[model samples]
Target: MESIWVGERVRVRGIEPEESELLMEFDQDSTFMRNNDRLHPPRSKAGYRHYLESGVGTPNDDEFGAGIESLADRRLVGWFGTNGIDKNSGVFSYGIAIGTDFQRRGYASETIVLLLRYMFGERRFQKCDVEVYAYNTASLNLHQKLGFVEEGRRRRSQYFAGEYHDVVLMGMTIEEYAAAYSLGTVESS
Candidate 1:
């Protein structure tokens, strides 16, 4: 689907082949890598191409990736989308990574709000899941502030930066999203 979901500060659009280099830059960013857990080693150009095409075959065959754009200047600041999706179960897992320069802005929150509206209102998803490293307090706060609850945690489940870190699992059901953000007013945001 060629759809662009726009929010007040950011917009989400489908990934383009020409933007592979930009995606590579994010992958190589040290700060971005620290907050996220990578399942595979760093990818080369060809590898990223395959990833862009296949989404590493997470949970199910269906996957979606979109570039996060700044609405003020129309620049690509990051990417976010679901790599793990199970339509039959009405559940999906998603993640987001903002470029170092783009952090602290409201782009991540705006993108997430738009994503939830699309997933819950249009796609009919029952819930959305996310995993964040304990060290990443900003991410944890963001999810919680957006109405996601702490479903569980895997203590010291991830090894990064020469030490083990707890993995915080967070989820928000459609009911929660509706309560936090009314579907009728989401478009105006």
Candidate 2:
């Protein structure tokens, strides 16, 4: 059943039970959690097991999740998913969390490109939207590098790390994706 979404350096597939321990590392990373605007304590192995068993990475009605596996070592590097899918509007929002060790390796870029292919090419979605905390300059830069335009910002809306910060809103349309990656310019691997 089409389980894997292949990219050049990484492939995304369903999260596995055995990888529960690895998944916990994301929660353990205080910086990663803060960037993603999360504050929950780390989940136990059993909790992770329960989460995987709950079919998180499996395709659902409106949203879906998947684990990013690096091709170099076939290790689960991170995860991403779509939420707030609007069928009528043909718009969707997504989030991603890459392990600290896996950051700044172009993995996030390729993963997002792969997801754009699925959402815009396969599902025929019109636009993809994302919100990044203002302090996450890396993410904001990555989004712009990938051709996502800064639509606006919610000033001082998100409170964390002892102060409030703006929520940077970004979006990419299907036309923009086609232009950026025309003829599959983004090399695989």
Candidate 3:
């Protein structure tokens, strides 16, 4: 997260070459994997490495840039990015760990707010979307609080662990995004 910004308690940065170990730590956490079922499993360290390097390093064909960072205690907390949705559409997805110590302290909201601002204001993207496990109420509420509408749902989409799970697609358009968020207020200095 060295390339990204550091707020009072959060550090956001592009996942870099040095953060390979972080991926290993993440793989060890079943709690993280269970919630984020949309992510594909890493077959090997090499695959994870390729993903990490592709996320925010160099210039990929469609990926503008992405970041992974810590929220509190300076640990690997989450990852977010402006990935290509269709052709020029900018789709975004984030996976955040509130941490064993720092759960439910508005960190995820803050991070999403920051991400939305950057994606809509700076990147000039027309839309932003996220996929969440339908059973995750906290995550579902968070997306709602951030003004994302329930775009759609895929029935029995994901079969994680031992059960079938549905994936919910949520989205906020650039129009709704700008009106719903107060990014313009911050720039009026």
For all predicted structures, in order, the TM-scores are 0.83, 0.91, 0.72
Show pairs that collide, candidate 2.
8-188, 8-189
**Residue lDDT tens for model 3, 37-124:** 4345555767667766664445443354445345545666665544434645565554554433344666667777776776667666
TM-score-best of 1 and 3: 1
Off by over 4 Å in 2: 1-4, 182-189
Q: Over 4 Å off in model 1, which ranges?
A: 1-4, 39-62, 184-189
For 1-189, candidate 2 gives per-residue lDDT tens digits of 232277669998888888888878778878888897577866789999898898766887448988899999899999998998999999999999999989999899999998888788778789999999988999999999999999999999987768988999999999999987742434345
Please, what's the RMSD in Å of model 1? 4.1
Evaluate residue 87 in candidate 2 and report its C-alpha lDDT on the 0 to 100 scale. Answer: 94
Q: Model 3 misses residue 39 by how many Å? A: 8.1
State the local distance difference test value for candidate 1. 0.80
lDDT for each candidate structure? 0.80, 0.86, 0.65
Please list the Cα RMSD from the true structure of every candidate, rounded to 1 decimal place.
4.1, 3.8, 4.2
TM-score of candidate 1 to 2 decimals: 0.83
Q: How many clashes (backbone atoms < 3 Å, residues ≥3 apart in a chain or on different chains) does model 1 have? A: 0
Measured by TM-score, the strongest candidate is 2
Return whichever of 1 and 2 wins on lDDT: 2
